[model samples]
Target: MPAKAGAVTMQQVAECAGVSMMTVSRVLNDDARVRESTRIKVMRAVAALGYRPNISARSLAGARSYLLGLLYANPSAAYISELLIGALKSCRAAGYHLVVESCDMEEAAIGEQMLALAKESRLDGLILPPPLCESAPLMAALEAARIPYVRIAPFTRLDAAPYVCIDDAAAARDITARLIALGHRRIGFIKGHPNQGASRLRLQGFQDAMQAAGLRSARRDICQGYFSYKSGLRCAEKLLNRADRPTAIFASNDDMAAAVYAVAHRHGLDIPQDLSVVGFDDTLIATTLWPPLTTVRQPIAAIAGAAVELLTTNRRAAAVLRQPAAPRRLLDYAIVERQSTAPPTTPD
Candidate 1:
C-alpha cells in the first residue's frame, strides 16, 4: 500500500527536495545565504508534503516560541474584527501563531501582567497597539525582558522605531480639507480618547487643517469623544442642539460617525441634504449604515499584516542585523469617499 495520505515529516521533505535537514531548516528560518534555487526546491517539497512545522519541537530546539503576542485595546467591533482578520492572516502565512490579549486602559497592573506574559511565553516578539505602547511602565518592562516588540501605534514621537501604521495625522488633515473644499466652513469635530496615539494624531490633523483655513479658533467648535457609538451620539446631540450647528461633522473614527448619523436622524435631519458627516478608519460600519461613510481608509489589514511580518522576520534579527539599531518601515493610507459626505447646502 502507498504511504498514509496524511503522514509527512521533515525527513521526507528533505528527501523529496534532495536537500539535507540543515538546508531545510535554513530555508524555513529565512537564512539569506541559501541560494534561491535551493530555497524554492525546499519550499516545493514543503508544499507537496503539506507539512506543518511542529511549533513545540521547534521552540524547544531553538529556545524560541515562534509566537507573537499581540496586545491591543479598543471596544469598537469593526476595528477589532478588521485588525484580527489582518493579524491572523499574516501570522498564518508566515508560519506563526498570534496570541491576542485585550487590555483595559484603566488597569494600572496591565504593564506587569504583560511583562509576565511575555517572559512566560518565550515569545519571539510582541506587538503593541496604543496607548499601551505609550505607557512608560510597559515600555520599561518589555525593554527589561529583552523581548523584541513592534508598536502598531505609538504615543511617543517616533524616531525609527519598529512599527506599522497609517499616517493618521495626514489622513485626518486631508479629510478635513476635503470638507472645506466642499464649502463646509462650520465643521464640527469629535475626538477619540486621548490615551490612544491615533486619537491624538487625528485631532492634531483636524487642528492643522482648520488653522490652514484660518479657522484656528474652531478648536472651541470641536467636541471630545471616546470613539464609541454612544459617545458619538452624545457629542452629536450637543453639536446639533447648539444655536449654531456646524454644516458638516467629522468624527475621528467610523463608530463615532455612526453616532452622528443617529443623532441627525433623531432631529429629522436629511443626510447630505440637511447635514454632512465624515469619519476616519473606513471600517465595516462605514458601509453598513444607510449612507455609507465618506472617510479615510485606515488599511487595517495591511497595517496588521506589516506588524506580523516585522515580528516574524525579526526572529532572525541576530543574524540579519549588521548594526545594533535599525529603522522600521511605515505604511501609507488613503481617503475613501463614500456617500455620507457632500457639499454644504443653502441655509434653511
Candidate 2:
C-alpha cells in the first residue's frame, strides 16, 4: 500500500466505519475504554480506506508522537543488522514508527549528540543496544529529557532501565568447556571490546572453565579485540604469529573467528588440522566462513523485540516510565556446533 497511506485521514476512516470521530481517536490511541467490537469495526474501516494517522496531528491531539527511537553503536555489523530487524518488525506491528540513529561511542560529545537527536525527533521512547546502553552520560541525558527507554544486553546498573539479555558468563563457560572436552589445552582467547560488559563476563566464563579443567597456567595465550573486523584481524595476526601458538582459538564473537580463519589460511594452516577455532555471537559470519563456525548463539533479534515490547506496552504513568516492571528479562542461549572446531591434531 505504497509502504504508507499517509494521505488517508481519521475523518474519512470514521465516516467509513459509521462511528464518531472521537471513537476513531480512542481506537487509534489504543484506549481500553473503547469496546473491542468497536475497535474491530474501526480497524476494518481503516483497512478499507487505507487510512494512516497523521502522527503530528495525533501528537497534538493525544500528546503522543507514536515514534520510537533505536540508537546503536555496536561494533558488529551483523549484530546491528539483527537488532534492526527485530526492532523494526515490533515497531511496525505496534502501530508505531521507528527512527534509527547511529552514534559513535568514541565521540566525546555523545551526550550532547544524543540529547540533540531526542530534542529533534520528539521521540515517544528509545531502544538502546549494547555499549550505548551502558553509557552513563547518554543515560543521564535521556533522563534529563525524561524519555522512556529500554536496553538490549545492558550489564551494568541492571535496575537503571528495562533490559533484555542472556546469561553471558554461563554461555561463555559452556562454549569454553566444550572446547576443553574436545581435547584442546592450548586454546587461544580473543576478548571483545572493553566498552561492552559482555566482554568481561565472557572472559570470566572462559577463565572459569579453564580453571575448572586445570588448564590454567602461569602463562597463557590471549589477545584483545574490539569486536570489529579490523580489530579481529589485528588480534588474530598477533596470536597466530607467535612461536608457541595455541592449538585452538576462541574469539569473543564470530567476526573475529572469521578473521582467525583468514589469518590461518595466509599462514598455510589447515582448519582443525593445524588449528581448531570457535567464536561467540553466532552472527552471519558464523555460517558464511569456510568450515562454518562453532559459536554461542545470542538472540540479538529476540532481545531487541523484547525491548520494543517493554517500551510500547508500558503505561505512561511517571512512576511506570521511571521504573519498568520485570526490569531485567533473561533469555536463553545455546552453543551452536558448526564445522569450525575439532580435537587438536596429535603433535607430530
Candidate 3:
C-alpha cells in the first residue's frame, strides 16, 4: 500500500492473494461464476496493493476493450456540441478514450456502416446520441456483433439498452402550459425533425397542454419544422404571414426559436407586446435573442457524461444483469424563464 500505486501490477495482486491471475480477472469483471471466497480474497489484495490498471492492461486482464465509442448524426449542432463536451469529460475521468464517429446516414445501409465503425475501431462499448440511437439497423448490427451500447434518448424499445434521457414529453408539456398560463390562447408551435424521436414527444407535449387548457390548436397554428434554422425560417414565414397570426409560438428547440425571432422582426411584430416565443434545450441560442427566450433545459452535456460513465463503469454490467430489459437513467428537466415570453398585449 505504501507503493507509488502506479507501479503495482495484477501479477503482484494475484501473488499476494495466493490466487491465479485468472481468478483476479473474474473478480474484477464480477463474472458471478467465481467462488465467493476467492473473489473476496482477490478484492482485498487489490485494495492492499493499490494496484491501478491502465486501459490497455485492464483490457488484457479481462474481456473488455477499455475503449468506448460514440456515434451521432444530429442536425442540431448545439446539442451535438454539448454531448461531446460531456462525453469527453467522463471518458477522461474514467481513464478511457472516446472514438466519435459520424455515420453517413445517406449510405445505403446504416447498419453496415456502424458494423464497419465498430470492427475498424475495436470498440469495447458505444454511446449513441439521437437519430443514431433510434436507428433500428444500427442497434441490430451492434446486438448481432455483441457490442453493448447506451442510448441518449430513444423513441422506442425502452428495454433495448442502457440509456440516459430526460422526460421529453413531460418537459414539452410543462413548457407549453407555461405559454398558456400567460393568457395566450393562440399559440403556434414548430415541430422538429420527424426522424428524431424526441421531436414527436415534444409535439405531443404541446398538444396535450393545449387540450388541457380547453383551447383548440387550430391546424394552421402548428407548422412543420426540421430542427434547422432554415426550416424554422420557412415555417415561421408560413405561420406568421396571415392577418390572424398567433400571439405566441413555441419552437421545439432554441435554434428554430431564434429563427422565429428573426421572422417576427421582419413582420414588424414586437416581442412580448405583439408576440411571445418559447423553445426547448436551454442551449446558448436561447439567450442570444434580443429578448432572451424562455426554454426547457435538456441537460445535453450531463446526459452525455452519464452515458459514458455507464459504459465505462460497472453500471453497464448491472444493466446487463437486469436481463430481459435494459436499465435506464432518467435525468431532470427545467423550464427557464427569460424576456421572450409574457402576457399577450391587448389590441387598441
Candidate 4:
C-alpha cells in the first residue's frame, strides 16, 4: 500500500515504480546515467505517491553532510541579497542546506577562520563570491584540507577550481563605448573595489574603449572606488568638482552609479542634460533612482545559482571519477540602457 501523501518515502516510491531504491535515488539526484524511461517511471511514481526523500536519512546513508557553504565579503547589500536568493533556491532544489558566512576578518586571519568554519560546519562544498574568491590563503587552506569549492568571478588562478562569471571587461567596454558614441569626449570613470578581479578588468575595458575612440582619459577623470555608495560619492565629488568636469561618468557598479546620481543632484546638475551617467550590475538600485540608470546587467542571481550547481555537479563526478576536471563558465551580459545616459548638450 502507498503511504500517505506527506508520509510517502523513497522505499515506497521504489516499490510502487517496480524499481530499486538506488534507481529512485539516482532519479531524484538528477544523475545523467539514469535511463529516460526509468527516470520517467520513477518520477511518475513519485508524483502518484507524493514521495519526498528524507534528506537526513539519505545523507547518513551516503556518508554526506548534504550541506554547502557560501563565503562572501562583498559590501553591496543588493548583490549579496541576490546571491543568497539564487543559492538558497538551488540548495532547495538539490535537497541540500546552505551555510552562509560573512568574512569580516583581516586578511591574515581569514584562512584560519575559514578552515575552522569548514571543520565546525562539516560543509560538503563551498561557494566563494568575489574578493573572497580571490583569497590565496583561503584557497590554500581549502586545498590542503581537501575541501572542494567553486568560485564566482575569481581574479587569479583560473584553473584552481570551477568558476562562473560574465566577461567584465567586455561589458565595461561596451558601456564605455556607448558613452563615447553619445558625443561625450570627456567621460569620467569610477573603478570598483581594488580587491576584486572584475575591478581591474572593468577599468581595462573602459580604457580600451577610450583609446579605441582616439580619446585620451586624463588622470583626473578616472577615480578609485571601493564598489560602495560612499566611495562613489567621494569619487563623484572629486570628478564633478573640477573646473573641467566630465560631460558623462561611468561607474563600475549600480551602487556607485547611484552615488553619482546623488552627487550630481547636490551639485545642481541635471542628468543627461548637464551630465550623463551610467553604471554596471543592473541591481535594484539601478531602477530605484529617479532617472533609471543605464548599466550592464550581469545576471547576478543566475551566476550564483550556476556556482552552486557547479559545486554540486563536481562533487558528484568526483565520487565516481576520483578526479573530475575543473570547468570554467563565462555567462553573457547585456547593456540595459535606461534614462541615465544621453548625448552631451555640447560635444567635448
Candidate 5:
C-alpha cells in the first residue's frame, strides 16, 4: 500500500466505520471490552478506508511513544544493514517505529547518551548490541534509568536481563572443528577489530576448538586484521607467505575471509586443494566471492526482530517488570560448507 502524504488520522476510520471515534480507538488499542462484532466492523472499515493511525498522536494521548531506539557501534555496512532490516520489519509489524543512532566504539559518554535517550519523552525502549552490552558504564546507566531494553548479544554478568543473540563461541568452534576434521592441522586465523564482542568470542571459540583437538594455536599461526577484505588479504599474505604456511585459514568475518581468497589466488594457491579458508558471519559476500565462503551464519534478521519486539513491548513505568520473557527466540546460525573448504593436499 502506498503511504499518503501528510499524517493519516484515526478520525477518518471512525467516520468511515459509522462509529464514534472512541470505538475506533478501542479497536486499535485491542481493548477487550469492545464487542467482537464492533471490532470486526471497525477493522473492515479500517481496511477499506486505508486507515493508518498517527503514532505521534497516540503517544501524546497514552504517554507512550511506541518508538524503539536502536544503538549500534559496529562499523560493518553489511552488519548494520541487516540489523536495520530486521528491526524495522518487527517494528512495523507491531505498530511501532524506530530511531537509529550510531556511536564510535571508543566514546566515553555512551552512558550519558543512553541516559539522554531514555529520558526522552518519545522513546519507549532501546535495543543495544555488541560493545554497548560489554560497556559497564553504559549498562549501568541504562539500568539506573530503568529503561526497558534488550541486548542483542549476551553479557557475562547481566544474566537476568533480556537478550537476543547467537552462540558466537559455539558457532566459531563448529566452523573451526570442520576445518580440523577436514585434516587441516595448521589453520591461520584472521581476527576482526578487537572492539567488537563478537570478535573476542569468535577468537576464543577458535582457540577452544584447537585446544579440544589436542593442538595449540600458535601466535605465529594467527595474524591480526580488522573486519575488512583488505585486512584479510594483508593478514593472509603474512600467514601464507611464511616458510611454514598453515594449510587452512579462518577469518573472523566473511569480508576478511574473501580477502584471504584473493591473497591465496595471487600466490598461485588453489582453494580447498592447496588451502582452505573459512569465515564467520555468512553475509552476502560469502556467496559473492569466487568460491563461496564456508562460514557461520549470524541470524541477523531474527536477532533484530527480537530486539525490536523487546524494545517496543509495553510495560508499566513504575514497576520493574520481570525482564520481559525473551521472545522465545534463538539466533539462527549454520555452517554453510561451500566451495571454500576441503582436505589439504599432500606437500609436493
Candidate 6:
C-alpha cells in the first residue's frame, strides 16, 4: 500500500514503481539520461504515493541547492501577483523552491541588497522583473558574483543576459492606432515610470501611431506617469481639466487607466461618451472597472514562467559547458477591446 500523504519516502516510491531508489532520485532531479518509460513510471509512483521530497535532505546529498530566487521592485500589485503565481508553478514542476525578494531601495542600495540575498539563500539562480531588470548596478553585481539570472521585460542591456518580453513599442502602436480608428483625433497619453526601458518604447509607439495618422499630439496632452494609480490620477486631472481636453486617453498601464475612470466620474463625464480611456498590461483592474478597460494584454504570468524556464535551462547548460548562456525570448501581445473606447462626439 502507498504511504500517507506527506509521509511518502523515495524508498517507498521506488518499491511501488519496481525501481531502485537511485533511479527515483535521478527522475526527481530531472536527469535527462533517465529513459522516458522509466521517468514516467517513477513520476506515476511519486504521484500515487503523494511523495514530497525533503528539500534540505536533497540539498545535503547533491551539489545543487534546488532553490531559485525572484527579485522585483515593480509597484504594480497585479503584475507582481501574477509573476509570483507563474514562477511558483514553474519551480514546483522543476522540483525547485522559489524565494521572492522585494527591492524598493534606491539604485545605489539595490546591488548590495541583492548580493546579500543571494549569499544568504545560496540560491541556484535568480529571475528579475523590471525595473530591477534594468538596474545597471544590480546587473554588475550579479555578474561580479557569477549568479545566473534571467530578466523579464528588461529595457537596457538586451545582450547582457537571458530575457523574456513582448514588443512593447509595437503593442503601444497597435493600441494607439486602435484609438485613431475610432476617429479620435485628439488623444492623450500617460507615460510609464521613467526608470523602465519599456516606458520609452511604449511612448515611441504611441507617437508613431499619431504621426502616421497625421494628427498633431499636443505637448499638453501627453503627461508623464509612474505606472501607478496615484500618478494616473495626477495625469488624468491635468488632461481632463484643460479646455481642449482629449476625447480619449491611453495610459501605459491599467492602474493609471483606472485612475482616469475615477477622475472622469469626478468631472461628471461618462466613459466612452464624454471620455474614452485605455491602458496596457490587461491586469485584474482592467476587467473589474465599471466599463471594462480596453488595453494591451501583456501576458505577465507567461513571461514569469518563461523566465524561470530560461534560468533552469541555463543552469543545466552551464553545468556541462562551465559558461553561462544569454538567450532572449519575445512573447506575443494583443489589444483587448472592451467598452471603454468610442469615437469622439465632435470631429477634430
Put down candidate 5 lDDT per residue, 1-348, tens digits, no spaces.
533633446787788778998988877765667787988899887766666677778877775687888888875678778899999999886678988988765778879877786687457788877767677777778777777777776535354567778888899899999988888789999888776677888889999999999988999988888786777878999999998899999999888888888888999999988899888877889999878888898888778898776555435222122454434346678988889888888631
For candidate 1, the lDDT comes to 0.81
lDDT of 2 by residue, 1-348 (tens): 422476777788888899999999888887768888998999898877677676667788886788889988887899999889988888876678899999999898898898888778888888888899889888888888788888777668556577889999999999989988988888888989898989989988999999999877223477889998788888889888989788888899988888899999999999978899999888887898889888999988888888888887664334224664446678999999988788888741
Model 6: which ten-residue window has the lowest total lDDT? Answer: 316-325
- Residue-wise lDDT of candidate 4 within 1-348, one digit each (tens)? 455655977788899899998899998766778888998999899878767667787777775688899998998999999999999998876678999989973668788889899988888888889989888889888888888888898778455578889999999999999998889999999999999999999999999999999999889999999999999999999999999899999999999999999999999999979999999889998899989889999988899899888777665436311245577788999999899888988867
Q: Model 6 segments beyond 4 Å from truth? A: 1-20, 30-51, 105-107, 319-325
Candidate 6 versus truth, CA RMSD in Å, comes to 3.0
Q: Give the true-structure RMSD of model 3.
A: 3.9
Clashes of each: 0, 0, 0, 0, 0, 0
lDDT of each: 0.81, 0.84, 0.84, 0.87, 0.79, 0.88
Please state the error at residue 151 of candidate 1 in Å.
0.6
How accurate locally is residue 127 in candidate 5, as Cα lDDT from 0 to 100? 81
Q: Quote the positional error of residue 143 for candidate 4 in Å.
A: 0.9
Alpha-carbon deviation at 82 in model 4, angstroms: 0.6
Best by TM-score: 4
Q: After superposition, how far is residue 197 of candidate 6 from its true place, in Å?
A: 1.3
Instruction: Write the residue-wise lDDT of candidate 3 on 216-324 in tens digits.
Output: 9889998989899999999899989988888999999899999999999999998978999999999988877789889999899999999987776544244332346
Candidate achieving the largest lDDT: 6
Error of 1 at 265 (Å): 0.6
Q: Tell me the TM-score of model 1.
A: 0.89
Q: Which of candidates 2 and 4 is the stronger one according to lDDT?
A: 4
Q: Give the candidates in order of lDDT, highest first.
A: 6, 4, 3, 2, 1, 5
lDDT string, candidate 1, 20-81, tens digits:
99999888877768898998999888887777777777777776677888888776778778
Window of ten residues with lowest summed lDDT in model 4: 315-324
